[model samples]
Target: MNHEKLITLPCQYPEEAKNSFKKLIFEEAYLLFIVLGTGETVNKILDLATKAAGSNQDPGMVIWITDYTVVSDIIESLNDPLNKLNDLDNTYAFALSIIDKVVDVIKKDENKLDILRIWKSFQLALKG
Candidate 1:
Protein backbone atom coordinates (compact mmCIF):
# COMPACT_ATOMS: atom_id res chain seq x y z
CA MET A 1 0.00 0.00 0.00
CA ASN A 2 1.13 3.56 -0.65
CA HIS A 3 2.29 5.10 2.58
CA GLU A 4 2.73 8.52 1.06
CA LYS A 5 -0.95 9.24 1.07
CA LEU A 6 -2.44 10.25 4.39
CA ILE A 7 -5.97 8.92 4.34
CA THR A 8 -8.66 11.43 5.15
CA LEU A 9 -12.35 10.47 5.44
CA PRO A 10 -13.49 8.95 2.13
CA CYS A 11 -10.99 8.68 -0.69
CA GLN A 12 -11.39 11.32 -3.39
CA TYR A 13 -9.82 9.27 -6.14
CA PRO A 14 -12.45 6.72 -7.05
CA GLU A 15 -10.50 4.78 -9.65
CA GLU A 16 -7.37 4.66 -7.60
CA ALA A 17 -9.33 3.74 -4.52
CA LYS A 18 -11.15 0.98 -6.39
CA ASN A 19 -7.92 -0.47 -7.70
CA SER A 20 -6.29 -0.24 -4.33
CA PHE A 21 -9.26 -1.89 -2.67
CA LYS A 22 -9.28 -4.69 -5.24
CA LYS A 23 -5.63 -5.40 -4.58
CA LEU A 24 -6.18 -5.38 -0.84
CA ILE A 25 -9.15 -7.70 -1.18
CA PHE A 26 -6.92 -10.33 -2.78
CA GLU A 27 -3.78 -9.77 -0.74
CA GLU A 28 -5.54 -9.33 2.57
CA ALA A 29 -8.19 -11.99 2.09
CA TYR A 30 -6.94 -14.29 4.80
CA LEU A 31 -6.45 -11.45 7.24
CA LEU A 32 -9.94 -10.22 6.58
CA PHE A 33 -11.50 -13.64 7.02
CA ILE A 34 -9.88 -14.30 10.34
CA VAL A 35 -10.55 -10.82 11.58
CA LEU A 36 -14.23 -11.13 10.84
CA GLY A 37 -14.60 -14.44 12.62
CA THR A 38 -13.41 -13.79 16.13
CA GLY A 39 -14.80 -11.21 18.56
CA GLU A 40 -11.26 -10.31 19.51
CA THR A 41 -10.23 -9.62 15.91
CA VAL A 42 -13.10 -7.24 15.22
CA ASN A 43 -11.33 -4.20 16.59
CA LYS A 44 -8.29 -4.66 14.36
CA ILE A 45 -10.46 -5.45 11.39
CA LEU A 46 -12.48 -2.30 12.01
CA ASP A 47 -9.33 -0.25 12.17
CA LEU A 48 -7.99 -1.64 8.92
CA ALA A 49 -11.27 -1.44 7.13
CA THR A 50 -11.79 2.12 8.32
CA LYS A 51 -8.43 3.08 6.90
CA ALA A 52 -9.06 1.24 3.65
CA ALA A 53 -12.51 2.70 3.09
CA GLY A 54 -12.18 6.14 4.59
CA SER A 55 -8.82 7.27 3.31
CA ASN A 56 -10.28 10.13 1.27
CA GLN A 57 -14.10 10.53 1.58
CA ASP A 58 -14.87 8.46 -1.48
CA PRO A 59 -16.44 5.02 -1.31
CA GLY A 60 -14.92 4.16 -4.66
CA MET A 61 -14.73 0.40 -4.59
CA VAL A 62 -17.15 -1.90 -2.86
CA ILE A 63 -14.68 -4.46 -1.63
CA TRP A 64 -16.51 -7.73 -1.18
CA ILE A 65 -15.38 -10.83 0.73
CA THR A 66 -17.07 -14.23 0.97
CA ASP A 67 -15.62 -15.59 4.17
CA TYR A 68 -18.17 -14.00 6.49
CA THR A 69 -19.99 -16.35 8.90
CA VAL A 70 -23.64 -16.87 7.99
CA VAL A 71 -24.74 -16.98 11.57
CA SER A 72 -27.19 -14.29 12.60
CA ASP A 73 -25.63 -14.22 16.04
CA ILE A 74 -22.38 -12.99 14.58
CA ILE A 75 -24.27 -10.52 12.45
CA GLU A 76 -26.17 -9.19 15.44
CA SER A 77 -23.00 -8.59 17.37
CA LEU A 78 -21.53 -6.58 14.55
CA ASN A 79 -24.67 -4.49 14.22
CA ASP A 80 -24.83 -3.64 17.90
CA PRO A 81 -24.49 0.03 18.78
CA LEU A 82 -21.44 -0.72 20.85
CA ASN A 83 -19.63 -1.99 17.76
CA LYS A 84 -18.36 1.53 16.99
CA LEU A 85 -20.75 2.22 14.18
CA ASN A 86 -22.60 4.55 16.51
CA ASP A 87 -19.46 6.50 17.27
CA LEU A 88 -19.02 10.11 16.25
CA ASP A 89 -16.37 9.27 13.70
CA ASN A 90 -17.48 9.51 10.09
CA THR A 91 -14.93 6.93 9.00
CA TYR A 92 -16.56 4.33 11.18
CA ALA A 93 -19.76 4.68 9.21
CA PHE A 94 -18.07 3.78 5.96
CA ALA A 95 -16.32 0.83 7.51
CA LEU A 96 -19.56 -0.36 9.06
CA SER A 97 -21.31 -0.12 5.71
CA ILE A 98 -18.80 -2.46 4.16
CA ILE A 99 -19.13 -4.87 7.06
CA ASP A 100 -22.91 -4.65 6.94
CA LYS A 101 -22.94 -5.72 3.31
CA VAL A 102 -20.59 -8.58 4.03
CA VAL A 103 -22.79 -9.82 6.84
CA ASP A 104 -25.88 -9.41 4.71
CA VAL A 105 -24.60 -11.80 2.08
CA ILE A 106 -23.61 -14.36 4.66
CA LYS A 107 -27.02 -14.12 6.24
CA LYS A 108 -28.71 -14.74 2.93
CA ASP A 109 -27.33 -17.98 1.63
CA GLU A 110 -25.83 -21.37 2.49
CA ASN A 111 -24.37 -21.80 -0.97
CA LYS A 112 -21.32 -19.88 0.18
CA LEU A 113 -20.52 -22.35 2.97
CA ASP A 114 -17.75 -24.14 1.12
CA ILE A 115 -16.06 -20.95 0.08
CA LEU A 116 -16.39 -19.58 3.60
CA ARG A 117 -14.64 -22.65 5.03
CA ILE A 118 -11.84 -22.32 2.51
CA TRP A 119 -11.38 -18.70 3.51
CA LYS A 120 -11.26 -19.76 7.18
CA SER A 121 -8.53 -22.27 6.40
CA PHE A 122 -6.59 -19.64 4.52
CA GLN A 123 -6.98 -17.34 7.52
CA LEU A 124 -5.60 -20.02 9.84
CA ALA A 125 -2.55 -20.49 7.63
CA LEU A 126 -1.82 -16.81 7.80
CA LYS A 127 -2.26 -16.94 11.58
CA GLY A 128 0.26 -19.76 11.90
Candidate 2:
Protein backbone atom coordinates (compact mmCIF):
# COMPACT_ATOMS: atom_id res chain seq x y z
CA MET A 1 0.00 0.00 0.00
CA ASN A 2 1.14 3.56 -0.75
CA HIS A 3 1.06 4.86 2.78
CA GLU A 4 2.30 8.34 2.01
CA LYS A 5 0.03 8.93 -0.97
CA LEU A 6 -3.01 7.44 0.74
CA ILE A 7 -2.44 9.60 3.80
CA THR A 8 -2.02 12.71 1.70
CA LEU A 9 -5.20 12.11 -0.28
CA PRO A 10 -8.32 13.88 0.96
CA CYS A 11 -11.32 12.07 2.47
CA GLN A 12 -13.10 12.24 -0.91
CA TYR A 13 -11.27 9.04 -1.92
CA PRO A 14 -14.15 6.65 -1.39
CA GLU A 15 -12.77 4.13 -3.83
CA GLU A 16 -9.49 3.98 -1.95
CA ALA A 17 -11.28 3.76 1.36
CA LYS A 18 -13.55 1.02 0.04
CA ASN A 19 -10.62 -0.93 -1.29
CA SER A 20 -8.77 -0.61 1.99
CA PHE A 21 -11.86 -1.68 3.90
CA LYS A 22 -12.35 -4.75 1.73
CA LYS A 23 -8.74 -5.77 2.13
CA LEU A 24 -8.90 -5.30 5.87
CA ILE A 25 -12.09 -7.37 6.07
CA PHE A 26 -10.56 -10.30 4.21
CA GLU A 27 -7.33 -10.09 6.14
CA GLU A 28 -9.09 -10.08 9.46
CA ALA A 29 -11.30 -13.03 8.55
CA TYR A 30 -8.39 -15.04 7.20
CA LEU A 31 -6.30 -14.35 10.25
CA LEU A 32 -9.17 -15.20 12.55
CA PHE A 33 -9.64 -18.58 10.94
CA ILE A 34 -5.94 -19.33 11.02
CA VAL A 35 -5.62 -18.28 14.63
CA LEU A 36 -8.83 -19.77 15.97
CA GLY A 37 -8.53 -23.16 14.26
CA THR A 38 -11.23 -25.84 14.28
CA GLY A 39 -10.92 -26.72 17.94
CA GLU A 40 -11.66 -23.30 19.35
CA THR A 41 -14.85 -22.74 21.33
CA VAL A 42 -17.46 -20.18 20.36
CA ASN A 43 -16.77 -18.04 23.42
CA LYS A 44 -13.08 -18.05 22.68
CA ILE A 45 -13.69 -16.98 19.12
CA LEU A 46 -16.01 -14.17 20.22
CA ASP A 47 -13.47 -12.95 22.76
CA LEU A 48 -10.71 -12.91 20.20
CA ALA A 49 -12.94 -11.16 17.68
CA THR A 50 -13.77 -8.47 20.20
CA LYS A 51 -10.13 -7.88 20.97
CA ALA A 52 -9.21 -7.95 17.30
CA ALA A 53 -11.86 -5.37 16.44
CA GLY A 54 -10.28 -2.82 18.78
CA SER A 55 -12.06 0.45 19.46
CA ASN A 56 -11.51 4.21 19.38
CA GLN A 57 -9.16 3.72 22.33
CA ASP A 58 -7.48 0.37 21.59
CA PRO A 59 -5.79 -0.61 18.31
CA GLY A 60 -6.77 -4.13 17.22
CA MET A 61 -4.57 -6.74 15.55
CA VAL A 62 -6.16 -5.88 12.20
CA ILE A 63 -4.96 -2.31 12.53
CA TRP A 64 -1.58 -3.45 13.82
CA ILE A 65 -1.08 -6.04 11.06
CA THR A 66 -2.15 -3.60 8.31
CA ASP A 67 -0.35 -0.32 8.99
CA TYR A 68 -1.96 1.28 12.00
CA THR A 69 -1.49 4.91 11.00
CA VAL A 70 -2.88 4.39 7.49
CA VAL A 71 -5.82 2.28 8.67
CA SER A 72 -6.63 4.81 11.38
CA ASP A 73 -6.56 7.62 8.82
CA ILE A 74 -8.80 5.59 6.52
CA ILE A 75 -11.31 4.97 9.32
CA GLU A 76 -11.30 8.64 10.24
CA SER A 77 -11.76 9.60 6.61
CA LEU A 78 -14.75 7.30 6.35
CA ASN A 79 -16.54 9.40 9.03
CA ASP A 80 -19.16 6.73 9.41
CA PRO A 81 -19.61 6.01 13.12
CA LEU A 82 -22.22 3.29 12.62
CA ASN A 83 -20.04 1.10 10.42
CA LYS A 84 -16.62 1.76 11.87
CA LEU A 85 -14.36 -1.25 11.25
CA ASN A 86 -13.01 -1.04 14.79
CA ASP A 87 -16.33 -1.97 16.33
CA LEU A 88 -16.91 -5.59 17.41
CA ASP A 89 -20.29 -5.94 15.71
CA ASN A 90 -18.83 -4.61 12.47
CA THR A 91 -16.04 -7.16 12.78
CA TYR A 92 -18.54 -10.00 13.07
CA ALA A 93 -20.49 -8.66 10.15
CA PHE A 94 -17.33 -8.47 8.10
CA ALA A 95 -16.52 -12.11 8.90
CA LEU A 96 -20.01 -13.16 7.86
CA SER A 97 -19.67 -11.24 4.62
CA ILE A 98 -16.46 -13.12 3.86
CA ILE A 99 -18.11 -16.43 4.69
CA ASP A 100 -20.97 -15.59 2.31
CA LYS A 101 -18.54 -14.83 -0.49
CA VAL A 102 -16.62 -18.06 0.13
CA VAL A 103 -19.82 -20.09 0.14
CA ASP A 104 -20.91 -18.50 -3.11
CA VAL A 105 -17.59 -19.24 -4.76
CA ILE A 106 -17.61 -22.89 -3.63
CA LYS A 107 -21.36 -23.45 -3.74
CA LYS A 108 -21.19 -26.20 -6.39
CA ASP A 109 -17.62 -27.27 -5.94
CA GLU A 110 -15.96 -29.98 -3.83
CA ASN A 111 -15.33 -27.49 -1.08
CA LYS A 112 -18.97 -27.41 -0.05
CA LEU A 113 -18.08 -29.13 3.19
CA ASP A 114 -15.51 -26.46 3.91
CA ILE A 115 -18.21 -23.83 3.44
CA LEU A 116 -20.50 -25.64 5.86
CA ARG A 117 -17.75 -25.83 8.44
CA ILE A 118 -17.00 -22.15 8.08
CA TRP A 119 -20.68 -21.27 8.26
CA LYS A 120 -21.20 -23.32 11.40
CA SER A 121 -18.21 -21.75 13.07
CA PHE A 122 -19.50 -18.27 12.29
CA GLN A 123 -23.00 -19.17 13.43
CA LEU A 124 -21.66 -20.38 16.76
CA ALA A 125 -19.46 -17.33 17.11
CA LEU A 126 -22.33 -15.02 16.28
CA LYS A 127 -24.65 -16.66 18.74
CA GLY A 128 -22.15 -16.27 21.54
Candidate 3:
Protein backbone atom coordinates (compact mmCIF):
# COMPACT_ATOMS: atom_id res chain seq x y z
CA MET A 1 0.00 0.00 0.00
CA ASN A 2 1.40 3.38 -0.93
CA HIS A 3 1.88 5.68 2.06
CA GLU A 4 0.14 8.66 0.50
CA LYS A 5 -2.88 6.65 -0.59
CA LEU A 6 -3.08 4.84 2.75
CA ILE A 7 -3.07 8.08 4.67
CA THR A 8 -5.84 9.49 2.52
CA LEU A 9 -7.96 6.38 3.03
CA PRO A 10 -9.24 8.06 6.20
CA CYS A 11 -8.62 11.72 5.50
CA GLN A 12 -11.94 12.92 6.81
CA TYR A 13 -13.26 10.20 9.15
CA PRO A 14 -10.56 8.06 10.67
CA GLU A 15 -12.53 6.36 13.44
CA GLU A 16 -15.56 5.54 11.33
CA ALA A 17 -13.28 4.04 8.72
CA LYS A 18 -11.30 2.12 11.31
CA ASN A 19 -14.38 0.55 12.85
CA SER A 20 -15.73 -0.38 9.45
CA PHE A 21 -12.41 -1.96 8.57
CA LYS A 22 -12.39 -3.93 11.80
CA LYS A 23 -15.85 -5.28 11.18
CA LEU A 24 -15.07 -6.26 7.61
CA ILE A 25 -11.73 -7.87 8.43
CA PHE A 26 -13.07 -9.76 11.42
CA GLU A 27 -16.06 -11.12 9.56
CA GLU A 28 -14.21 -11.97 6.34
CA ALA A 29 -10.65 -12.87 7.14
CA TYR A 30 -8.81 -14.84 4.48
CA LEU A 31 -7.75 -17.63 6.85
CA LEU A 32 -10.55 -17.40 9.42
CA PHE A 33 -13.50 -15.23 10.25
CA ILE A 34 -14.53 -14.16 13.72
CA VAL A 35 -18.19 -14.47 14.66
CA LEU A 36 -18.26 -11.13 16.43
CA GLY A 37 -16.06 -8.10 17.03
CA THR A 38 -15.79 -5.61 19.89
CA GLY A 39 -14.21 -2.84 17.89
CA GLU A 40 -16.99 -0.46 18.78
CA THR A 41 -16.59 -1.01 22.51
CA VAL A 42 -12.85 -0.52 22.26
CA ASN A 43 -13.33 2.58 20.13
CA LYS A 44 -15.73 4.07 22.66
CA ILE A 45 -13.24 3.47 25.43
CA LEU A 46 -10.46 5.01 23.41
CA ASP A 47 -12.60 8.09 22.72
CA LEU A 48 -13.32 8.50 26.42
CA ALA A 49 -9.65 8.09 27.27
CA THR A 50 -8.74 10.76 24.72
CA LYS A 51 -11.31 13.18 26.13
CA ALA A 52 -10.09 12.51 29.68
CA ALA A 53 -6.47 13.08 28.70
CA GLY A 54 -7.22 16.29 26.79
CA SER A 55 -9.41 17.71 29.55
CA ASN A 56 -6.57 17.47 32.04
CA GLN A 57 -3.46 19.24 30.89
CA ASP A 58 -2.04 19.27 34.42
CA PRO A 59 -4.09 16.74 36.35
CA GLY A 60 -1.83 17.07 39.37
CA MET A 61 -3.10 20.62 39.77
CA VAL A 62 -6.70 19.43 40.05
CA ILE A 63 -8.41 20.83 43.10
CA TRP A 64 -9.01 18.27 45.81
CA ILE A 65 -11.48 18.70 48.65
CA THR A 66 -13.71 16.59 50.85
CA ASP A 67 -17.16 15.78 49.47
CA TYR A 68 -18.44 16.24 52.99
CA THR A 69 -16.75 19.61 53.44
CA VAL A 70 -20.15 21.14 53.02
CA VAL A 71 -21.32 19.05 55.97
CA SER A 72 -18.31 19.46 58.22
CA ASP A 73 -15.14 21.44 57.44
CA ILE A 74 -13.77 19.97 60.71
CA ILE A 75 -13.20 16.63 58.98
CA GLU A 76 -9.64 16.40 57.80
CA SER A 77 -9.64 16.15 54.02
CA LEU A 78 -7.30 13.69 52.39
CA ASN A 79 -6.44 14.84 48.91
CA ASP A 80 -5.06 11.40 48.21
CA PRO A 81 -7.99 9.38 49.47
CA LEU A 82 -7.11 6.53 47.13
CA ASN A 83 -3.99 6.10 49.25
CA LYS A 84 -6.15 4.71 52.04
CA LEU A 85 -7.69 2.04 49.79
CA ASN A 86 -4.35 0.45 48.86
CA ASP A 87 -2.00 1.46 51.63
CA LEU A 88 0.27 -1.51 50.99
CA ASP A 89 0.55 -0.72 47.30
CA ASN A 90 -0.60 2.39 45.45
CA THR A 91 -1.17 0.74 42.08
CA TYR A 92 -4.89 0.50 42.86
CA ALA A 93 -4.92 4.18 43.71
CA PHE A 94 -3.24 5.00 40.44
CA ALA A 95 -5.70 2.86 38.47
CA LEU A 96 -8.68 4.20 40.41
CA SER A 97 -7.69 7.73 39.52
CA ILE A 98 -7.65 6.77 35.88
CA ILE A 99 -11.06 5.14 36.19
CA ASP A 100 -12.36 8.27 37.85
CA LYS A 101 -11.62 10.19 34.67
CA VAL A 102 -14.94 9.64 32.92
CA VAL A 103 -14.85 5.85 33.33
CA ASP A 104 -11.76 5.73 31.22
CA VAL A 105 -8.58 4.30 32.71
CA ILE A 106 -7.19 2.30 29.81
CA LYS A 107 -6.55 2.52 26.09
CA LYS A 108 -6.79 -0.27 23.56
CA ASP A 109 -3.79 -1.07 21.43
CA GLU A 110 -2.88 -3.70 18.85
CA ASN A 111 -2.39 -6.34 21.56
CA LYS A 112 -5.74 -5.60 23.20
CA LEU A 113 -7.42 -5.53 19.78
CA ASP A 114 -6.52 -9.17 19.19
CA ILE A 115 -7.85 -10.11 22.62
CA LEU A 116 -11.01 -8.07 22.05
CA ARG A 117 -11.65 -9.94 18.82
CA ILE A 118 -11.43 -13.32 20.53
CA TRP A 119 -13.40 -12.13 23.53
CA LYS A 120 -16.18 -10.84 21.32
CA SER A 121 -16.30 -14.19 19.60
CA PHE A 122 -16.53 -15.98 22.92
CA GLN A 123 -19.25 -13.66 24.11
CA LEU A 124 -21.31 -14.28 20.99
CA ALA A 125 -20.77 -18.02 21.21
CA LEU A 126 -21.95 -17.97 24.79
CA LYS A 127 -25.03 -16.01 23.79
CA GLY A 128 -26.02 -18.69 21.31
- The most accurate candidate by lDDT is 2
Pick out the ten consecutive residues of candidate 1 with the lowest summed lDDT. Answer: 87-96
The TM-score-based order of candidates, best leading, equals 1, 2, 3
**Top-TM-score structure, candidate number:** 1
lDDT of 3 by residue, 1-128 (tens): 11111111221354544444333323422111111112455334333323332222222111111121131211122223423222211111011122121111122333453435333322322332
Greater-lDDT candidate between 1 and 3 = 1
lDDT of 2: 0.32
Which residue pairs collide, candidate 2?
none
Per-residue error (Å), model 2, residue 76 = 21
Q: What residue runs in model 3 are displaced by over 4 Å at the alpha carbon?
A: 1-38, 60-128
lDDT of 2 by residue, 1-128 (tens): 21211112222455565565556555544322212112224333334444444343422222112222334544344323334244421232222233313111111122333334444534433442
The root-mean-square deviation over C-alpha atoms between each candidate and the true structure, in angstroms, is 14.4, 15.0, 19.3
